[model samples]
Target: MPDFQKIPSNDVIDTLLKRVSVRKFTDEQISDETLDLILKTSFRAPTSSNIQAYSVVVVRDQEKLDALAAASGGQRHVAQAPVFLAFCADISRIEDALVRNGHSIDSNNLETGLVSAIDAALVGMSAYLVADSLGIKGVMIGGARNKPHEVAHILGLPQRVFCVFGMSLGWPAEAPAQKPRMDYDGLVHFEQYGKSRSGADAKKVVDDYDVALAEHYRGQGRQTTDASWSDDMDKKFHPWLRDDLRERLKELGFDFR
Candidate 1:
C-alpha cells in the first residue's frame, strides 16, 4: 500500500479536510474590497488552453436575489446570503472575439460546452476555498440549474452563457457538522480502475458508508435509515434529475452535440 503518511499537511489542506457547506449566514455583508479580492484571485485558477470561457455575476440586489432564490428551487440561502455569485459557463465572449477575428462559433460542440463548464467549476472552487480561508463560509448552489431558462433570464445571460452553479457568501450564522463521505477504496483507484477490487467489494464499500453516514446523521439528531446514503440517493436521483436540462441547454446554445 502507498504510504499515506507521506501526504503533506498545511493550512489549506487542513481547511479543505474540514470543509462543510454553510447555508445559514449572519446579516453581515461581504465588503466590496474583499469580494473583489476573492474574484480577482479566483480568476487566476487554471483554464483550458487559457480560453477563460467563464464569467461571474455578483448579485447583491434584494429583488434579484429573491428572484434567483426562487429560480434555484426556493433555496433561501441564495437570497439571504450577503452575496450570490453566479458562476457562468460562458462562450459568448469567445463568439464575439471570433466574429472580430473573421471566425464564428458554428463549430462549437460538446467539448466546447464541457471545457467552459469545467473552467467555471475550477474558478468557483478556488473562490470558495479563498473565502473559507478568510473565515467566510458559503455553499455552492447547483440548484441554479433547476430553472435554467429562468436563471438565464434573471441574470440577463447572453447566448452561449449559462450559470454552471452559484455560491452564496457571507459570515456564518450556523456551522453544520460535516457529513461522512464514502470509503477511500470506493473512490480512489490505483494503476487501474479499482485495481484488484471486484464489483462486490465496491458494493460493500458503499454499504459500509451508508451505515457510517446514518450514524453521523443520528449523532446530529437527524433520524436516518441504516442505508442512509443509498436510500437518499435512490429517492433523489433514481429518476434522474432535471430531465429537460438537455433541451434547455440546447436552447442556451449547448446541445451537447
Candidate 2:
C-alpha cells in the first residue's frame, strides 16, 4: 500500500507520477500556438556549456509522417500522431563556428557525442512533460536509430547531425497505466556507484520487483513467465540495441574512435 500522507500534492509531481507513454491519440490536431509554447518551454532545459547543440525538426506532412513510421520499425502510432518531432544532436553549427575562428574540433570524440546527445535528451524530456501539462501525450521512438542514414536522408540533416530519437505526439484517446520502475534503494547508491549492488541486496530488490511487476502484468491479462522482469532484462541485452550505430555514426562524419 502507498502512503498517501507522504505523497506531495504539488501539481508538477502529480503530472510526472501519472505520466505514461501514450500510443493512441484522438484526431484533434495540436494548435500552432500550443506547439510554440511547448517549444519555448523545452528550450529552457539546460544544455552542456550552454552550447545547445541540438535541433528539433517538427514534421506534420502526411507523406513524411508515413515514411517516418516506416523508418521507425513500422510503428503505426508515428504515422497517425498529430505531430512527430525528430530530435537531432547537431554539432555542424559549432563546427562551422570553429572553422571561421581558425580552430577545429579534434575529430569527434566520445565527449562530443555525449554532450550533444545529452542536450537533445534534456530538451526532449522537458518537451514531453510540458506537453503532458497541456493534456498532450506521446511516446519516444528509439527505433529512429535503426536506420539512421535513411532517417537523415528523409529529414535532410546535414553532416555532424544525427537523429538521437523521434517522438509522436497528440491528445491521447485514453490514459494507460504507468509501468513499474526499478526500486529506489537498488538504483540510488550512497557515495559511489555499485556499492549498493551487493549479491544479496541486488537479488532481493530484483526479486521483489519481479514479483510486483509479474502481478501487475497478470492483473492486465498479459501472459508471461514468473519473475518476468529478469526475463525482460535478458531479452533486452540478448539482441542489443542498434548494433550498427557505431558504424553509422562514423559514416556520418562522427569519429567516435
Candidate 3:
C-alpha cells in the first residue's frame, strides 16, 4: 500500500475533498437557485487585470444537450447531467467595449488569447469547487474541443469567442473511487529543479500507486487490465492525438497570427 497523507484543513471544507469526476449521475434536477449560486461563485474568480474575458453558456434544453453529447465523442453523461455549461474564452465582449470607447481592438493579438484562456480556466476551477461545495457532482469535458466549430455554432457564440471546455453537472448516483495521483516527491521540486528522478525512483512511486489502485478497484469488483501507472500513462500520452483546436479557433474568427 502506498503511504497517504490527509489534508490539514479542518475548516468546514464544504465536502470539496469528497469531489470526484462523476461520469454517472442521478435524475435529480438541480434547482435554479443552486445553479445561480454556482455561476455567481465562478464569476467571482480572480481574472488577469479583471478583464473577465470569459463567458459561460448554460445548456438546459435537452436537444442542445444531446447535440453537445454527440460533439463530445458521445459521452452520455453530458446529456444525462441536469446542467451543461460551455465555458468560452471570450474577447468579443471586451473588443466591443473598447471599440465603443474609440479604442482600436486588435482581435489577433496573442496577449488577448492568453488573457481569455487564463480567465476561463480560473472560472472553470471556481465552478468546479462551487458545485462540489453544493453537493453537486461534475466533470470537466475537455472533449468539447473535439469539434469546436460545430460546438460554437450550436452555442451561438460570436466571433472572437471560443469554447475553452464544458462541464456536466448533476448529483452523483454512486460514489466513485478516488483516483490516485503521483507522490509529492515525484511532482514537487525544491526552489530549483531537482535532479531527474524518472529512472528507478519514478517507477517505484508509480508502481506503488498502481498496486493501491488495482486493489481498490478489485475490492469493488471492477477488473482492470493495467497494473502499473506507466501503463495508464502510455495510453494517455499518445503522440497521434487529434486536436484541431488551432484551425477551429481560426475558423471561429480568432486571429492566431
Best by lDDT: 1
Model 3: per-residue Cα lDDT over 1-257, one tens digit each: 63335655542453665667888888898898998899997899899998999999989899999999999899999999989989999988788898999996665766777789889989998898888877788899988988988899889998888888999999988788887666667666556455344433666667777887777778778776557555666776665444566767877766666
Q: Using lDDT as the measure, what is the rank order of every candidate, best first?
A: 1, 2, 3
> What ranges in model 3 sit over 4 Å off?
1-8, 11-14, 101-107, 195-228
lDDT for model 2, on a 0 to 1 scale?
A: 0.89
User: Estimated TM-score per prediction?
Assistant: 0.93, 0.92, 0.84
Candidate 1 structure quality by residue, lDDT tens digits, 19-84? 999999999989999999999999999999999999999999999999999999999988999999
Better of 2 and 3 by TM-score: 2
Better of 1 and 2 by TM-score: 1
Judging by TM-score against the true structure, name the best candidate: 1
**Per-model C-alpha lDDT, please?**
0.92, 0.89, 0.82
Name the Cα RMSD for model 2: 3.5
Better of 1 and 3 by TM-score: 1
What value does the lDDT take at residue 65 in candidate 2? 94
Model 3: per-residue Cα lDDT at residue 52: 90
TM-score: model 1 vs. ground truth: 0.93
